[model samples]
Target: MTNFLPMTKDDMSKRGWDQLDFLFVSGDAYVDHPSFGPAIICRLLEKSGYKVGIIAQPDWRSTNDFKRLGKPKLGILVSAGNLDSMLNKYTAAKKYRSTDNYSPGGQAGLRPERATIVYCNRIREIWKHTPLIIGGIEGSLRRFAHYDYWSDSVRRSILVDSRADLLIYGMGEKQIKEVAAQLSAGISIENIRDIAGTCYRTETLEHLWDYIEIPSYQDVVNSKKDFANAFKFQYLEQDPIRGKTLAQGHGEQFVVQNQPAMPLTTPEMDEIYDLPYQRTYHPSYTAAGGIPAIQEVKFSIVSHRGCYGSCSFCALYAHQGRIIQARSTESILREAQEIVKMPDFKGYIHDVGGPTANFRQPACEHQMDRGTCRGKQCLFPNACKSLDTSHTEYLQLLREIRKIPGVKKVFVRSGLRYDYLMAANDMEFLRELCEHHVSGQLKVAPEHISPKVTKLMGKAGKETYLKFKKAYEKVNKDLGKEQYLVPYFMSSHPGSGLKEAIEMAEFLRDTGYNPEQVQDFIPTPGSLSTCMYYTGINPLTEEKVYVAKTPHDKRLQRALLQYRNPKNYELVREALVKAGRQDLIGYEAKCLIRPPRNKQNIAVSQPENWNKKRRLAPSRTQHSKTKQTRKI
Candidate 1:
């Protein structure tokens, strides 16, 4: 009897409908929260006077479950949940993940490896000629020819691979609306090629205009350089304002991607967030452990979308765009009131931020008009002179959220960029953060302490991190608070070698900080770092970058990052000797590890020609020919 979207045929019958307008198939469980893409898209379609139902995590092995709601009136919308299906199922080490947060009861293997392709294939067995549209982080990021970390090879665009009629690439509120309207107006899915933020396959490029053609899938598979160059073109043309149509060839056909959808205005953002949502997992899931992913966002409110802090390893900018679109304070406050009204409401409002918490507005005025600078970064190589450094509005919004009637402790757990905060040149926000927001420790991502690696990561150098550390200590000192800074670090990135990893270990030694959590870099699709990982060349620079592809090579770097762990002792020693830094193996006070005693001495499994292998590793080189890649 509840107003949840029809997940069952009976629910459709309850709504007095024989067939629905859209039957959305998602890789994740049915969670009616706005943070979930499937929820927003379905709710938006419903708002447009279309009946929408969701078939979450359908048994892809057969067509029976997919037929539960029969075929949709317009088309079947598909998504591999909020996360890519491959990423959701695998870990950085290419091992089975222990659990899937998006699944009911936090189960794994409920969804297939490539859910969109698998689901569509199964549905095709039943509804052979029905329109199939795919979109989500997985579909969007892999909308072009991409390197699949799991498969360890170049794969065709999802639009081509899944044989979907269309692919929505970015945040889909706008694109979905346009697509649904066009479909309702009796436009063939094949003819709906002009919508922004969408991709489609064509037999020829005759219908396309204002487009740049990248190398074909065959071209990339044959040459690494061509792969890097193709990614560069896809990266540069992602902006809605300045971006142009891009087409990549697949066999005899071409997959064309239209310009990105424009960033949603504040009122537009408010409208999407203000939509009626049940704000939790479907009732049937309650008997199980419920959807694990909802717990993170059920109480947390997303204040904005998109991030300008373009760390190379992050895919946010690729999916969300660099231009920030934030909800009005009143809109956010209304969501907070709704949170307070929940039956299980606690005094604590967990987190209030987006991809980057401190970035509530666009970096500068130019982004809204001209789009973000193509080949330049906003915060890397020092914050741009035109960057907006003030945090007044964000700070004020936080103040207002905490003062809400039932809220007791409001936290900002979505980590803020320390570099962005430092660029402000004002301590007011920092002081306020230390005094109020932090829960004894504030986690920041300096990522690495080595200059070479950090530079390649598009991150601030060690100097900036040190300056921020000193200032943070002073702020906490002035406030008489014992708050600490927990910095996040990544190992085995594109530019990192044993030498850079050692530099990080030494920094940890000097700081006397031992991190319990270490993030080893994972090369997922649609990220600059992933491109570098696949090609061993920086797409933005066309420069040869050192990449550790071997499992042993990666282990060495990860071991060096967590050098203090006793389990890493042998691996750390192996890495140090391989790097020709055997002096670090001594019992000196500055040494990474004390020399092993006779009883403790153990041999680590390493290549017979360790020195030769280390010497053979790729090193950085200058190649400026392909300099037109995406920086953010």
Candidate 2:
């Protein structure tokens, strides 16, 4: 049931076929989200018959929308807007910073790297020799050679700076429909090195280059800061012809392929969530006034894909494989009744959840024929004596999508694995997920409260986030209201520093809660927390610790988790007086600590140098001399 190749728009003006066997090209904007992983590899290469077309956010104002799909037998897939903008260009250089500090209600800004290297050199100047295939989550978490955090160094290998001919890393729907059915059967880009979550670039040594297996771009150019420990260090099981080999050798003697990374069939996730969504917004972001598409149109729905809470600053259990794979709850209520027949259905659907949305299933049941369960601790971290924690079909699929009918509210807004909801056997499903899917704040991440930095970020401790914040404040004080939990904390992870971010800013000043948004550990790219943020230790427990590893002490331990900013009170008062913690300095530190008063409101809002206040006003010397003479 996988043979697709049907081009439309009157079959490309009845066969003068201006290049399309597949094209896509995105950075996100084709009514983004819930059509993820590059809109399911462009609807699985238009259902396997390839002749696709898409250019979502392209138009570098002439390069004719990357040459209006006109030079394509096969070339171009690209995707940079999910999985944290495909492998970190430090969230696309903090969205090309001219200051908007990571999505302050985003405005489709930040495109730099010279506008993504001039939109990949104008789509290779209108497809010269086609093929560009870069793959999502910021080109598969910056495929090979890491650390760029807005060019702070060690770059190269986003497939040789996006010149891209191949790079289809992680969860690419059957490696982009088997590289668009071997480039629409004509093959040859040196025969796509037998495609399997591809990453090409070679000149020889072919153990199947024409059939595809030429990986070893000089062991990712001599182990570029150990490309995610050389792709999870070796795990081959199938590569006689491409698909599943998950890493091999080069640098620090690599080897993690004990076989297990592949899971995307539920009719390839319901034919990539039945494509063609016009959830809308992106006529160059509604003509640059941006930041509105009904506030980034996210009626999203996924439910599950993979993650069994490995969390060493996660890469979703190494790119989707801690095994979960959900979808059918009548395919998430027919994609939440087609996002309430979208004309921007804003009765709030926004997010249902995935990756950790109360983990829908597959922690084991020989995970659909013996694929994952080689278990290594994760049954609510110490409760897995054959764990079940009964989510009861994810709380009966969020109570049948809050009984459908123009659903007005149903957000789990992702990130909720609170030790699998404090190993739920029913706190009445967290009081029916806080009386019908909270929107009046519920977030939860508990990223660190310092049980030795949540066991070096794999997590579970600080009494399991103070027992899920006293069972979400005793189910919001017996549903008497005033619901709140937002939590989420992380600062310089890699065995945290400044005494575990001042013991997590004194456990958020003794749990009154301070987080006015904090997250500073950005080591991204196939995480194990960016190999303990570039080898401060713990590449699988080689331990060692104390690493705020600079970036001005990881921005003063992420401004001590928003100690109510006065530009983070003189860098958390010189990191709490160089960690002797001068009793958390100045304001009796009970927590939401905002004192240095934005450096006394930037020295009382500047602008007062009218000739240095008329040369320190009063020419004092003359006045003093006159007074002295009078006294004499």
Candidate 3:
């Protein structure tokens, strides 16, 4: 076992302490989720003989937390996945800033300004010369210039905003390992530009800064002209080669460098999944008194990595890659055995799924050869002809898992790819999956009703969703079970303004299903959808689209998904009014319209108005007195 000193201020002040072999800062909560990308990276660094300490959910109250970790002998590894400061703050801000979600008790509160960026900047301030390497979903997705929904404007690359030494996009296991090894051997961060999966700014590039010249916060505050220019600059993506050339042209500006994308190796993924994780809820946050032992565990395992769905509003494909990589059945079974050995091992194994539970391998055989896939998408309106529909091996693996002792139920709670499901020639495997794995409901993503919006999102059309829904129902009826499909939907995506959103609402109403939850479109960095959100054009096709630019409009589109709520009634009414969509406001227009409220009834109460008048009168008197005193 590798021996390491405990992390503390005292230990950090020691002679050799100036140089930490490794330091891991996670944007996620300390508790390990199956999708804890940062935790896995930290463990990998530990395994490689690095002294690693984690700063989880960093407190930006001061720079002390960053300083306490001490200067790393190598550098800092920052991951903002599973828990991103920006996403966390944005969610909070949305709740607090909205009049509808607000509570009298101040239930929703203001978030700290620029939470993620500020936290990173503070760390840089503390360790002035230390290399700060930013990765994970937040960094990877926002590596380039893109639209920021929270700020309602285009923003600079995350590297510039975070002031990090380097930014790594996509999965960072291999890239980080290489960076650590190189830095430990006395290589400078500047010399490591050739490494794939990294982005950095350099002074040498010419014209590189021309398009990327964003106004400083003060500059924007001081002049509207500077702010507008910065907004335009924010939407641009610099040509990588030209950016490098421009850096060389400009002697003063540092050359911006980017490494090619690096993918994780099979062995590395296997090693990460095999970590000794206590996969229960954090003891402090859980309602249950104690941490549940491994014996009480029923089933747990991740099936694959990455997604190919390419939903425009989704950030998963950006960070995890669109390629699907699965571990062999033998390796997965080994994990199952470990869970079965736990003292409280239950007969049920709760989860065995990944991004899309049904997608076990790459859609095309070219992926095996590391060749470019000519296929536009794995999940088009229908399954790709090249897709391997065979599930014999997968079925056999499930059978083997069931034979294991202490295993009762093996559940697949992850959302399934219905498009892929409907294409299968044989439904036997799917029937078996339902019979053994499903716990009454199978979740799937049928993001929108309109084909136009669906095409923009690179997802299957409404017909596909309906076809799968019908097939699923038939299967359930045949089995004499009441299993249901819980379909996931997204509102206010880049191409989905009020019109498309209303169409989705109408579709939901017609189906007689009011979804319990709906995901609002968050234009995270590095996604194809994010590009559309930023530029108002599809990156691939370069087609212009109607983007919901205003915050209120976006909110209205999101509210349409929750048609059951009366508060949403005002939202729908306002949206229709603003869009001049009077045709949809009537009682029976074949549209999903919210009922109008009496305007007079909603006026401020007499007592509340009187209280406001009383408060303002005193403030006015105080102001008059202060002015008279100053004059005297």
Candidate 3 — which residues are off by over 4 angstroms? 1-19, 32-34, 96-116, 205-262, 278-299, 343-345, 368-370, 555-632
- TM-scores, each model vs. reference: 0.94, 0.31, 0.77
- lDDT-better candidate, 1 vs 3: 1
Model 1 / residue 533 / CA error / Å: 0.8
Ranking by lDDT: 1, 3, 2
lDDT per residue for candidate 2 within 242-357, as digits (tens), equals 23444332232221121232676666566566665444443334455443323433576877787777777766554566667777778778888988887858767867767577
- By TM-score rank, best first, the candidates go 1, 3, 2
Which model is ahead, 1 or 2, in terms of TM-score? Answer: 1
Q: How well does model 2 score by local distance difference test?
A: 0.60
Q: Per-residue alpha-carbon lDDT of model 1 for 1-632, expressed as tens digits?
A: 68799999899998999998999999999999998999999998898899999999998888899999988889999999988898888878999998988998999999998999998888878887788999999998998889999999999888887888999988899999999899999998878988999998999998776789999899999999999999898888779999999988999999989999999999999999999999999999988889988877889999999998888998888789999999999999999999999999987887889988899999999898899999888998889999999999999998999899999888888868888988996799989888878777777889898888998899999889899999999999999987777778898999899999999988887776776667888899999999999998999888999999998999999998778789999999999988998888755556787566665567444446554422321111111122111111
| Stronger candidate by TM-score (2 vs 3) | 3
CA-only RMSD, every prediction: 7.4, 25.8, 12.3
Query: Where in model 2 is the C-alpha error above 4 Å?
Result: 1-46, 50-167, 170-178, 188-190, 193-198, 201-272, 276-335, 339-408, 415-441, 444-481, 489-492, 495-498, 512-525, 537-632
Model 2, C-alpha of 60: deviation from truth (Å)? 48
State the displacement of the C-alpha of residue 339, model 3, in Å, after optimal TM-score superposition: 2.5
